[model samples]
Target: MPPTRPSAVPPQGDTGARADAYATAPLLNCLLREVARPVPGAGEPRVYRLPSGERLLRVRGGRRPAAPEVNAGGTWHRVGHAELVKLVAEELQAHTGLSNPELPAEMADSRDAVAALLTARDRTTPPDDPYRRSEQSLLTGHPYHPAPKARGGGPVAAWLPYAPEAYAAFPLVLLGVREDAVAEEGDVSALDAFGTAPPGYQLLPAHPWQLDLVGPSLTDAFADGRLIRLGTTAFDTWPTAAIRTLYAPEHDLFVKFSLDVRITNDVRRLWRHDLLKLRRTNTAVSAAAPSVTPGAWLSDRGYRTADFAFEELAVLVRDGLHTHLAPGTTPLLAAALVESFDDTPLDGLHDPAAWWTAYLRAVVPPTLELFARHGVVIEAHLQNCLIAVDATGTPVQALFRDAEGVKLLPEVSRAAGWERLVYCLVVNHLVEIAEALCERHPDLDPWPAVRTAFERQSLRLDLPEATALLTAPTLPGKTNLLLRWTGADGADARYLPLPNPLRAR
Candidate 1:
């Protein structure tokens, strides 16, 4: 049977073209990286041979590849987002010796989601603060995931108002859980600052979207008075790149909630297991913060939830920028540097090499030293990192966050942990930044500066893994596309070796 197409037709005019472009870049990136072998030739448009079905594919541009075409019947034909999804489905099934009905649908849903976001963005005004704008600028998220923008296949109306890409900000629903039923740990006192609870209750803020999702499950809790609706917060919280996490600028606080939506790979819930381990993880990362120096760690301070609905209604309090950020330095999401935005530091870069070197200095030392000295493996991917730039748009400091994704040493074998670090730091973080910079300044070679940064850190920290990284022929590249297609755990990261740019030519 031919593949099923997405329900929503592509939007009309320039919006349609833009939706296609935004959606196609990441899907093409995944296909090219994981499954397609480069065809030996250089020209205006690059070509690749899909080994699974022996099909030929071509695309123009680098960094964010666009205008995809497939060769069939002795001619190359342009393929839109829907057709691209079909082609990916066919290639994956053939390549993996497996079939997946869900992924194709998700790919379609993701494309449709982009269209919705583009439309919503037209009507909304982006945040005035550059930092907030950077935080919300991930239009094409997770550059290698097939359905990075997929919103659990829900209606646009259901999710659009809360979408960060659409510059969304709204008040969080406040609930009062009976004191006896409240389960919490550490410094969750930050949550109580939102609003007051009645005589026998405690304040618990919940993501309105999450409440909409798990409302049915909490019906009895509400009926029995375990949970009471106390109305929404008076102030608004801007949704961050991580949709489940929101930033309350008024309070200078970040609150993460258990969203039962499948974003990217996992159902993004504050899982019981992760929450149980949250204190231990946060403590360890906090203790390791000194090793990063001027670079800092945004510790997940604590979490709060009702015992009856632990995972469904749980909320985590994270350290906000005001406390951790250096005086006068502006923190920009690291992902935004690669994704690009209005007035992004990279946009007006006068010296690409110097800018990149400063970036490496801010980001690399902290990531490696934590692993080497403190035995902390932070998931220092772009989203989890914030690069604080000075007034002149030069990167001055790096701040890392998300304890839920942090892995400590000894708990994980050194080898396993090192591999994870390399993938997250080098492949996921540095490669994207370098490519984006090089794309902008084609005359500059970003890798040598990267190599120097790594070598200097290896010597400074005496990290053997860092030394080995320089000579290594291949870097571990996460296979996001195949992982999703095979229905693997999102945490169960499988890597394919890509030619290491750090290695001397």
Candidate 2:
């Protein structure tokens, strides 16, 4: 897709008025993916059989499905987010005979959140910096998630100040942890540069919102003089697409903090179990994929936290783009690449096929090779991946991060790991880019090039899943709508079968 105007200035005015359409699309996708059924032999006005006593649901479809209607009495009526939420609640209760008042409220809350973000954006100018703008560009997040924008049903004021989508940036709150209570692992020495801690303590950086979240519980720690405030960083760090992670442009570093809010399916806390396993996962990934020219891994160097408030105040030191990113190349979040931006290098391409070829060449091989050789399963989803483009805006490098999401072999069954790998790489990451390309170049069939990319790599990879991958009719698609509604653990991913594009001729 061509780099369009600022997201706030979409094709339709980005007013509170169009927030319904913007908010409704993702909701509809969630409903369709999780519960809606298609009417057999239905013609023209596309109808999908929805869950509430088998009600007929209709919508205009393309990439952004719109104008949802449900058949009631003799005619069709529009279903806004409120009505949609009610319908979903009713259907869920009827289908499972279990009422979830919370999810319905959350669905409505998500709509309201979108409205607020739109209002905030229209009044505030988006950052001119491409990277910052890209970071803030996710207005309608997770196209298939039910409550993608819901901020734990908390008041907007509680989170709005630090919202990356609102072009917000703030300095991290640094703390001095008592030397006795300081619990750290690996090389977190870079944290020492944020500010000097008193000789009796070590430097610890924390997310301000999280600090505010757990303030009452931490009273004893502060009273005992285990934690001391050391002020903030000189330069403000911009929150990346992952809300917990912040990128400091000056130091060229990323620091991840634990926020207990539930963004999508899971509470965003950096759990102790995951943190305990981080070093081993990170080391495996680094060894699995060495310093390949166009492919790199941004290591999560180490983490620092006080033993007293382990998960709450933890800060992860991540390798910055400076070392991994090719010199003279600008890297943007792959998630933002799919959304509307002021200037996207992908838009500059004269040939979609050639550009697609380069993209596949840069991204596909290393991931396959990693799994085949090292048995490291990378959660290479959009938020965890970045594509760096040369001066021409063509992609030159692929960088991946988030060791917490990576799984090693034998930790999970090989089949289970493969399912995760396919969903993240193919369904979550590649599908979005492919759809954007097809939208811009309607005549171009991007899947054949995708097929070619896999075929070339299959020769190098010894994995048996490769042949089945090219021909499998269905692939695992994470059922976010159901996952959230059922209150499943965020990492406890349950996938539904989706029509596989790779299988399409």
Candidate 3:
């Protein structure tokens, strides 16, 4: 990682067009040029900064268009366009419990329409009846909303991007309350009942972001922890303003916000901290084996940056796809090792050493090249990545989180930031995993796999950039994961020697 800087700066909603009002809108371009300049007819729109540092423009007179009077089951409530956005925000916060609710382009219209649209979005799903019929409002209590499940109940629908369909969010409301309770009583303790805290990992004192999920109970938890030594107002780069909730009923499951310069420097540092925490959590989770599954990602509630509060909602599975490497699980380390040595793994084929080879090949090159590609880059270190596996011994998923690691393509930022991304993602993450894989699978080659991954991902890069990523040929030291340098003639293979077994004894 580049020399760590002590500090830094700042940084949605659904659109109405596609899914309905409650749907996430398209990303609005914040460029000043994109802003509609005031003219004769349209009033000067109100500009507000979102939590992520993006800007929101409200047309001064933009009202939610009036709906035609209908003799329908439910009456259409009249509201303004901006009020619609606010309601959407409130509803999202109410449902998803994320800190900020985004409004994309499609949802940016009048009030009554937005509300009707939001209602329609939820109503589109099939109701949970014996026949599994479709209904507009499946889960009652709050507003008439979509039902995530069909009556017979196969599997819930996949949550959508932008405008969040009420999959997980709506479930929080379903926890403990009656169908009508959500509608009448705003409090949603009905669902919080199901969220059992993992053994020893007591729920950390929640920040405001988690208000919707944990309910008011967090306030009590915080006060108790503070009165004792357990709770702390320590800063995680943000003067303790950013509350990190931990469920260490047994072990530490780190909870922190995504990067937001406006909120505090901690947001930017979250990736690194989380990585460290994941490692720690993994060790703890492993120790408690029979009781707790080795968990990784925890939910991130509310995080406010400059103008808006970004809401994060999700129950993360720790590298669910790549968990074979966990303790007691058998992994084909030999195949992983071979892949790290070269680029021969991504051909839709598998090798015992596929994991190792792929790591060295793909992870390292992109990381090292990031600096030259842009001035300010991102770090794709270990914490941001999630390695997963399927039933059979095979690599299935490699989920990368913490968008903060995505550096500005050098042209956008600077060498300082850009290089951090390269170092963190490629060198730090890929290399370590490659090393671990190599330790397990010695027979497989990592070289070809490394080469193959670079060739695939680097399809858009130039030769030099490509070469920088594939810097294996230039590294020094036999034990060094990246074969940085192989001498003038590129003579012979020089691998790191095995350690003396006697040393352990």
Candidate 4:
């Protein structure tokens, strides 16, 4: 039987409290992981000491920690989102000896964004489709990023309508670029189906929200005959977990646009350098896909944009599920399994161990094999992966997408590539899912199964990294809190050692 649907929406009137709880978890995770030291003890609410300010902090729950309290004169007091932001800012400043005016505001903006999303979700009906629900279910996104949901700190009205968390689906605003001014590579033929351009132009669809942001800069192009506004797409495209990328079910296509907004770490524009390398990176992954069976690579087919507004107006066409997904399966975002939704396959499982085993089987091998054989290190983080399940909710296949995040072996040192893969696959992806599964099934220990998965895959592929992974005492956890505090580039990943769950008995 298919899983029953439960309301994933926040309880009606407690939106503020719910938002605070949802927002606080990730921020706390960042602070705890990057700056604070855990105070060892057996207790209901675990305690931690902020090394910078010598402050005592405690929180209830694991994975998504809540009910945060700070010790003041040997007494505990609750801290709300605002107070928590203040606390984090102070802690980070003292810890790093660097004050960032922007990150703190972003931390607060992220909390406010959650409140706005909750308010929007209350009025909006979630999509009945399980896949759509799973894609939109990331209310507490990037569980370790301080400002995962901050939409460039813009007013809620500007970005909320385009938010995937609110179950938003909107039509793409089509534009016509003068044929002479068009700069494109690979196969972007799917874009032509959206609408027709005049004889001298090519059809280029733009994200409505992006169009609004970049519209002012395109005045000269619009005023001249270089870019003409065509109408909107007849069918609405649903935004995936990656905010700028949208899935068009009707066309069986995924179109990614460049948005000039900071989401999580960086401004999400499709930069010229990345765009220049897209085809090469995508080609390598596509070639490697056949070697890894039961796991598919959703090929980013091509991109289209006006040469005049290359990065700002660029749109990428990606292969859709019709071509890649298995016959009798529905693909759910792997990240969604961590941030659950109504009818999540992980919910009420008869045997969570078996389910988790199958999950590891579907997800791990392809990632490891691709690296060992093809020298392709995909960003196999939860958001970039899709776990397809049968009607019985058994994970049958894994699909991975997003070419922009991929790394080629020789391009980066073998050690660097392997480090990136381990961080993405182990710390970011598997750990989150394992914790979520254990959260649901308290008696189930997920690490042994994880160890077995890696061991089996390592033996099959003769991958030395996988073998070493089984015994590694520490995993490289990305220092997102420190990265932002230091104003490091988003792509410039820095790692701190985290206790390896796989190595634990």
Q: Indicate which candidate wins on lDDT.
A: 4
Q: Which candidate's TM-score is highest?
A: 4
Candidate 2 clashes between residue pairs 3 or more apart in a chain or in different chains: 37-49
User: What stretches of model 2 exceed 4 Å from their correct place?
Assistant: 1-14, 41-45, 291-293
Question: Model 3 compared with the native: what TM-score?
Answer: 0.30
Per-residue lDDT of 257-339 in model 3, one digit per residue for the tens?
33222111112223333332443333332333222222222212222111111122212221221322344332221212222
Error of 1 at 457 (Å): 1.5
Model 1: lowest-lDDT 10 consecutive positions? 1-10
lDDT of 4 by residue, 1-505 (tens): 3222212223445888878888888888888888888787737778898966567999876777788899957899999989999999898888878999999999889988999998898898999998988999899899899999999988888998899999999999989999999999999998999988889999999999999999999999999989999899899999999999999999999999999999998999999999899999999999989889879999998888999899999999999997788988999999998875888877879999999999999999999999999999999999999999999999999999999999998999989999999999999999988877777777999989899988988899889888898788999999988898899998999999999988956
Model 3, position 101, has a per-residue lDDT of 22
lDDT of each: 0.88, 0.82, 0.29, 0.89
Per-residue lDDT of model 1, residues 1-505, tens digit only: 1111111223346787778788898899999999998878646689898856557998987767888899966699999999999999999988988999999999989989988998888888878999999999988899889999999998888899899999999999999999999999889898888998999999999999989988999889999999999999999999989999999999999999988889998999999999999999999989879757768998899899999999999999998999888889999999988775778777757888899988999999888899989999999999999999999999999999999998998999999999999999988999988877776677988888888888988899889899899999999999999999999997888999999999999
Per-residue alpha-carbon lDDT of candidate 2 for residues 343-365, written as tens digits (9 for 90 to 100) = 87657669878888888887888
Question: How many residue-pair clashes does candidate 2 contain?
Answer: 1
RMSD of each: 4.4, 2.0, 25.6, 2.2
Clashes of each: 0, 1, 134, 0
Return the clash pairs for model 4, or none: none
- What 10-residue stretch in candidate 2 is worst by lDDT? 1-10
